[model samples]
Target: MIWCFLTPVLGAVVAEQYLGRVKTILYSAAIYGGGLAILVLSSLPAVQETVISLPGLLLSLFLIGVGTGGIKANVSPLLAEQCTSPGQVIRLLKSGETVIIDRELTVQRVFATYFLFINAGCLAALASVEIEQSYGFSAAFAIPMTVFIIGFIALMTSKDQYNSSAPDGSIIPSVLHALGITIKHKGNLNCTRPALEPVESRYQEYPWTNSFIDDLQTALSASKVFLLYPFYWAAFSQLLTNFISQAATMQTHGIPNDILPYMNPITTLFLLPLLDRLIFPTVRNLGYPVHHFPRITAGFMVCALAMLYAAFFQRTIYVSPPCYDHPRSPTCMHGQVPNDVSVLLQVPAYILVASSECLASVAGLEYAYANAPKSMRSLIMALYLSTVSVGTFLAMAVLPLTVDPKITWMYIVLAMAVFGAGAALWSVPVQRKEAG
Candidate 1:
């Protein structure tokens, strides 16, 4: 996971320094497809028996990671580039009404749409579990490989139609240059100094524009806000591992154990449209501020609530199971008569987390791009996305508590941690104001 998260920074560096976004993405498609092909081959029973080497599996994963890295670093910036308007535009409606098109909201909508399609892809991927069960692992792996091929073809056909950013050389030299200047004049660099160099004069020695410096400050400020995100992602990451375990302890009523994780994406699919179309617009109409901070803070609280519910769900499962005290016993496994609680009851928790994604995850994407300087957008976005890996790392510390009986406590502790992080996140702007 760390490799998966960190590889994108390398891609971002390559994109920002050498090849442009379009060519980088095109290059990634081939690598990504080849990796998937390798994965498909690895799943074959014949290959599994002899030819499936650990090095081969690791290499395939590495290729996939790099390919995803290039695509991940560029895709968001590319989508955001399509919305050329940077501020609100007032438009007269044909029906004699008026609407203000806010650029931030427009960007938010683009990300929402992006997430919708992302989850739509997830829905398709989730179906592959059933394919693996029904047909074979090769069939399941082949599905994504095929999709990657189609995507590669589509990208190639439309290569000329997309917007691309040229690599402006590496960011490292620029950073070192700034640091050298900062250290050289450390004693004299005061904002209120009367003899301070004019913005143009500063540029001559700095090797960067005044605007770049100012924007870098903004990017740094935004990056501080994201430091809290690992807690949020850690709480959310539960859905991938522990939440499914929780569901396995409950009555699925004929649903597959793997099927429950799909609820997150499925719920997200519905909530995106609800928030984008109805809920958010109504709030705006009512003269409320619908900015990123408020949305993200609310998301954290919602996520905390979701985990609280999960903790309770796990507690209930402990008491009602066939194994009783032995939560990990084979009698408690799936295909056995599940615990007294119905898996459908877990829906609210899924919905809450889904709302968190709409409020926090999608907003995080918009916040990363909207707040970042143009020169550092991909790097900043990569930093934001890496929070997932950070959170996963944090979860590793609590791995011992992830087992059956201690799992309830793990959820409780995580929920509390997230709530605290959310509150801290909410206080950042306040702290900034105080510092200013």
Candidate 2:
């Protein structure tokens, strides 16, 4: 998971400098397909006992991580780049009335749709779970491998239809040189602006313009906004790891423990259209605009609430039945049985997390793309994605506390941490600046 998040930093640079977006995605997909194939083969019953199995599985995971990183860094930027319209336009309708179209809203909708399909794809996890339960791991892995191949083939056949940007020859050196000049001038960014520099000065050594400096500043501001995201993601990450363990300690009633996590994607799928078609429009018409900062702040609060509920729910599990504080106690048939609490009760937490993703995650994507310099869009997106790596590391640091008695406290701490992050994000001066 860390690799999945971290490799994107380098992957974005590669996409921008060497392979334009389309080719990067194609190469990444090929590598990902290869990894999935190896994963399928290694999971087969015949191969599981062989010496090659573990190494193959490890290598496959690494390739999958690298491939996912490349795809993640480029796909959203590429999707948004497909819209060629101006930011705002005045047009005449069929009824001879004039109307103004806001491309920012269009981009927001595009991202919402993009995020919707992402969750829709995640619904395949539900299918995988069922397959794993019914047909074993080999068949389960094979399904996605096959689907990936189909998707790759489709993309390859239609590659010429997409709009792609050419590599903007490396900008890192110019950025570094500009920053060096800024520092030399006592932290004045304007010192590097082309109009302000002397003819023979080092600033003139580069070809960057005043607008590039402004864009660089804007990108830096966006990065500051992203600082809070790691805390948000750290709390959200529990859904993938600790939440499954929580389910195992509850009464599943013949349901698979892993199945509950699908509620997240299900909730996202249900809510995305609702937000796009109804809620956002209704709210805007009612004279309240939900901008990125507010939306993300709301998401943070909602995630905190989810964690708070999980904490109480964990407490409820501890106090519940044949084995208080330890659902898997030896007294209860040596950990063979769970407590009386129903695992289905976890659905609400999943719903809240999904709601948070709708707000924070989608808004983050739009915000990053909207604010990023044209040449640095993928790089900024990768920086935004690296927050997930930070969040995962945070989760790992607290992982030892995920044990029986300490689990409830862990949730409580996470709730506090996320709420603090939201408060900090809301209080940031940029939020008020954006509002103004």
Highest-scoring model, TM-score: 2
Could you tell me the TM-score of candidate 2?
0.92
Could you tally the backbone clashes for each prediction? 0, 0
TM-scores, one per candidate? 0.88, 0.92
Query: Which 10-residue window of candidate 1 scores lowest in summed lDDT?
Result: 187-196
Q: lDDT by residue for model 1 over 260-354, one digit each (tens)?
A: 77888999988889988999889987988677888888999999999899888788887875765455477556446666778887888888898
Candidate 1, residue 436: Cα displacement in angstroms equals: 24
Angstrom error of the Cα, residue 402, model 2: value is: 1.9
The CA lDDT of each predicted structure is: 0.79, 0.87
Question: Which candidate leads in lDDT?
Answer: 2
